[model samples]
Target: MSIPLALQNEKFANCQESIKILYLVDDNFRCMCDDYNITKENVEFFKQKTEEDFQCRMEYETLSIELEEEILRYIAERTDQ
Candidate 1:
């Protein structure tokens, strides 16, 4: 699971403080979406531009490995199922 270089520099984690990279990938290891905490307000503002099924919420803080892992797990679990 290699992350994008642009996303890599987009205010993500340092294995210590917090992780803010939201990597929304499809089944083929391709990123369907990517966003960071700093840009969440923008996401909310422009969310209506995207389609109905596609959604990325801002309820969760973007500074935790658990959140990243949870999203990965969700992708993995759903794809596997």
Candidate 2:
């Protein structure tokens, strides 16, 4: 199976399988993963900008963190099932 973009983070490395399973079975989780990956890509793109884009980068970074937390929470909830 192809790895989900959100699972590319080292933080989620160990739980990739679990998250992938949830990604396949849950629509909401799949959406969150998609959002997370997009936000992550935005962060990377912003990182290449000049100093004036620092705030934008920070904002994207914060959003990515929130998405990561939500993804983790969803995975935890499903794993406990």
Best by TM-score: 2
Candidate 1 collision pairs? none
Model 2 lDDT at residue 50: 56
Q: How much lDDT does candidate 1 score? A: 0.47
TM-score for every candidate vs. truth?
0.21, 0.55
Tens digits of per-residue lDDT for model 2, 1-77: 45567567889988877897988888898888888888888887777675558877899999999999999999999
Residue-level lDDT tens digits of model 1 in 3-76: 54444543444521222223333433233323433365467567755643343333334445678988899999
Q: Ten consecutive residues with minimal summed lDDT in candidate 2?
A: 1-10
Worst 10 residues of 1 by lDDT: 15-24
Candidate 2 structure lDDT: 0.82
Q: Which candidate number has the best lDDT?
A: 2
Once fitted onto the true fold, the runs of candidate 2 whose alpha carbons sit more than 4 angstroms away are 51-81
